[model samples]
Target chain A: MAVSRGFVGRRPTDSARVPPGQYVTRDFPVLSAGPTPYTPLDTWDFTVRGLVNRPVSWSWQAFRALPHENITVDIHCVTKWTKLDTTWSGVSLDTLLDAAPTQASHALAFCDGGYTTNVPLADLRGGKAWVVDEYDGQPLDPEHGGPARLLVPHLYFWKSAKWIRGLELRQADQPGFWEMFGYHNYGDPWKEQRYQGD
Target chain B: MVSKTVETPRVTTIAVAIQDWPGHRAGQHVDVRLTAPDGYQTERSYSIGSAPEDAYVSLTVERLDDGEVSPYLVDELRPGDEIELRGPVGGYFAWDNELGGPLFLVAGGSGLVPFRSMLRHHRASGSRVPVRLLCSARSLELLIYREELIKLAADDLVDVSVTLTREAPDDWRGYRGRIDPALLAGCRHGCFGA
Candidate 1:
C-alpha cells in the first residue's frame, strides 16, 4: 500500500464499531444504477415464492395489517459508508418465511427496478432481516427505496435490495444482478468483500 | 499520475497512466484506495471521465466540504504522485456504441463524470447515436467540463441542455431552475419510445 503523501483520515472514535475500510457518514448518500422507480401504493405488493411449500403474497393493505416491529440497526454500504442506529419499521422476514414454509437454503431478492441480490436463507432467518417501509418513523422516500425494501443489515447495503418486490427461495445459490456483473456473490462488508474475489 | 486539470473551483480531473490496463468501456468506475502514513486506509469509487480511446484514465472528483477522500483527491494530489486504484469496475451502468440509442443522459453536479466518458467514446468511435444530455449545476461556473460539453454539443447528432439551479448570467440562455417532471416530459418527446 502506497501511503498518500499528506493524507490524514477522520480517525473515527469507535473504530471497533466500523468494519474494515469503512468510515462513518452521518449523511445518507443516494447511489443508484438507474432512475428512481415510483411504484404506486395501490398496486404495491410483496411475495415469497420459489421452492416453498406454497407461494404467499401480501397486498399493500394486508401487509400493513400484519404485525410490525420498530428496529434500530447499523447499516454498512459496500461503497464504504456506515450509518449507525438507523431506525426502521417493518415486518420481519421470519414472519414472511413462516407463512411460506421454505426448505430452500438460498434466496434471491427481486425488486421493482430489476435490481436483485442473493443471500443465504440462513442469514435471513430468526428475526435477522425485514421488509421495511418506514424509515426514522417516516414513509421511506422513493430515492431511498420507498413502498417497501428488504432490510438485511448484516450484509452490505446492496444486499438490502431497494423497492423490493419479493424473495424467491432457491434450492441452490445463484448470483444476482450485481453479483453477475462483478460484486461478490455473498457480500460481507466486514470481510471487505466489495468486488468479486475480495 | 499523468496530468491534472482544474474543472471547477471544487472539481479537479486527474489523469493517470496505468500499466497493463485493460481498456474500459464508458461509464465504468475505479476504486481508489489511499493509505495514510500510519497505515490507516480509506477507499472510494470514482467514475472514469476519460474515454477508452484516451491515452490515460481520468477521474474528475468534486470536493465535498465534509468528505474525507474527495478533499485530498481534489486538492492535495499532484503529478508523479503514486496512487493505488483498481478496476474498470462496474458494468451495469456502462454505455457503449453497440448499445445504440437516442440516449437521454441526465446528471446533476459531478454525476456527469461517467457521461463525459460516454460522450467522448461516442465521438472517438464516430457513433451516430442521437444523444441528449440534460445537466444541472448550481451555476455556469460550477459546471464541470463546461467548454468541452459546449464543443461536443456542436455535433448534429448531440443535443446538450444545461439547467442552472442556483445562478446564471443576466443574459444567459439555456435552462433555469431544477429538473422536474415538466422539464423531462418536454425532453422526452420522440426520443424515448421512437
Candidate 2:
C-alpha cells in the first residue's frame, strides 16, 4: 500500500482567485445532502413570492423566454473545492425581481425536496445572482440542478440552491436546510465561514 | 495516533487523542494534514467513525493505491505518532439524537464510515430509532465493521444487509449482485415487514 510520487504539498498560489482554506479542482464533484431530484421540465415552474406586493409565477416555457446573461465565473464550495472559469446562462435575479417588485430585504431560494437557502436581497439583485438553466452551453444536468438553479458565485455553492422552484422574499433573515443544521448562516468562502459561529 | 486494522490488510482505524477536543456530531468529518520531515504537507478529509459518545476521535482510512495521503495513514502510521489535524468539520452531513427515527442508511464500500458513527451513536444513546443499513461491498472480507454490524443487527437495534458486487461465499444468503431496485425493495420489505 505504498504510493511513491514525489509529492509537493498544496499551497495557495493566487489568493485573489482562490479563497483561503480552498483548493482549485478541475473536475466538478457531485456533493449533495441527499439524492438528486429529477423533475420533468413540462411540470417545472418558478415563482417569486414572500414579501412581494404580488407574487409572480412562470411556467417552464415562460421562464426560458426571459432575457438571459451568459456568465463565466468561479464558484467555491464550503467543502473546500473551488471550480474556476465555469460558464452558465440564465435569467438574472434583477429581471425576475423587476417583474414582481418586492419590499423585502432577504430572499430564500426554495427548491425541490424541501431545500432552502437564504441570501440578502442585495446579493440577488444587481447582476449578482441568477436563476440559471444552462451550463457549458447545454441544458443543465439534473444532478447539477438542471432545469434551473440559483447561481450566486459570490457565496458558497450551497447558497446556489439546486432544482430551484421559487424565491421566498422575507423581511427577516431565516436559515435554510443546511443553515438551520450547523452551516454558517452566510457562507462566505473568502472568510472560510464554513460552520456556525466561524 | 493509535492505528488498528479494521477491515484487514488495507483499512486501518487511527485514533488520535486531542486535548479539549470540541465534541463532534455523528457522521461529521475532519481534515487531517500530514507534514513531511521536509515540511511538505498534504491534507484530506475523512469521515469520523467513532461515535461522539466515544472518548477519542477516530478515523478509518482505506489505502487507495493512487491516494497521496491514505497510503501513509493505513500502512505507515502507528501509535504514539503525531500528526496535524483539524475538525469536526462539515456540519451539513451529520445526524444526531434530536433528529430521530426510522434512519435509512446506504453505504458503498468505505462509504460506511459515517453511517457507522450514526449507528453507534444510535445504539449508545439508547435511541429507539429504527435503522436499516444496506452496505454494498465487494465481499464480506472487504467490508469494514462486519462483526460489529452483525452484533448490532443481532441485538435488533439496527437491521443490516449486504450486497456483494464481486464474489460472495457459496451459500451466501444476503445478495450476490450489484444493488438494483429489487434489492432495495427487498431490504425495505424485510425491515418494515418484520
Predictions' DockQ, in order: 0.79, 0.24
Instruction: Identify the runs in model 2 with alpha carbons over 4 angstroms from their true place.
Output: A1-8, A12-16, B6-10, B33-44, B63-72, B89-100, B126-130, B188-194
| Candidate 1 ranges beyond 4 A from true positions | B188-194
Q: Please give the lDDT score at residue A179 for candidate 1.
A: 95
Clashing pairs in 2: none
What is candidate 1's TM-score for chain A? 0.96
For the predicted complex of model 2, DockQ is 0.24
Instruction: Indicate the fraction of true inter-chain contacts that candidate 1 also forms.
Output: 0.90
The CAPRI category of model 1 is: medium
Top candidate by lDDT: 1
TM-score for all models, in order of appearance: 0.95, 0.85
Best by TM-score: 1
**Deviation in angstroms for A120 in model 2?**
1.6
> How far does residue B55 in candidate 2 sit from its true spot (Å)?
3.3
Ten-residue segment with the worst summed lDDT in candidate 2 chain A? A1-10
